[model samples]
Target: MPKLTFAADLQWRRRFARAAEGLALRFALEDARDLRDEPDGADDPDHVPLPVHRDDYDFDACTDMFFQDTDVLMLYNARFDGIEDPGGETNQQIGMGDLCTAAWFDPFGNVKTRDPHRGFRR
Candidate 1:
């Protein structure tokens, strides 16, 4: 895996620094040995899905627990593969939520904001 640098700009950097001070990040790696095992939320009893790997580890729990500190801000970065649209070949979106983690803001931070779906206060 490549090194993913995490930082913020002048304004948000101060906010992030103030919020993340003295916080400890707990990292856990999920282990999977079987490649043909039943999935966790399989609705169909007859269908066995491919086994999950370390990459499938869900961070919701960690986020929920840590995000309770309402005074702090949690930033997460997500990347997806394949981009095919009349707009271009890349689709990058940033999501910012309130204390409830309900996306109060989600915009294309990396791309031009000429799109109709682009806005800062959605």
Candidate 2:
């Protein structure tokens, strides 16, 4: 991985700081104190879907579980690929498909994991 320049680092910091602002996140009751692996209603045959918006449930239990903290990722860069003077030392020959790890697919339907040897052989 190429070491990003100071400017690039600053840009990313700003981007993340921006994304963190006014971010409305959803959360269940924090009264449990421990973490848990709640099964999805659709996936769990025994799970009854929560009624629309409001239902009452007792908070007291043997709930010894905690959830992973929400991770905030801001996918932005001062320089990008596929254009003239895209900057950021993007040499796609040696298999660094993109400087970005967040763009799973591009507009042209090309995945970001393309390599010279990962395609059809003629």
Q: Rate the local accuracy (lDDT) of all candidates.
A: 0.33, 0.32
User: What would the TM-score be for candidate 1 when compared with the true structure?
Assistant: 0.22
TM accuracy, model 2: 0.20
Report how far off residue 55 is in candidate 2 (Å): 4.3
lDDT of 2 by residue, 1-122 (tens): 21232335544544434433223222244422222234443345444464533323323331222212221111223343231122434433333344342321222343243342343322
- Candidate 1 residue runs with Cα over 4 Å from true position: 1-8, 21-23, 27-64, 67-78, 81-122
Model 1 collision count: 0
Cα lDDT tens digits for candidate 1, 6-119: 322454444334434224353221122122233653444443465756744355554565444322222232333122121333322322223222222233356343354332
Worst 10 residues of 2 by lDDT: 66-75
Off by over 4 Å in 2: 1-8, 21-122
- RMSD to truth, every model: 15.6, 16.3
lDDT (C-alpha) at residue 9 in model 2? 59
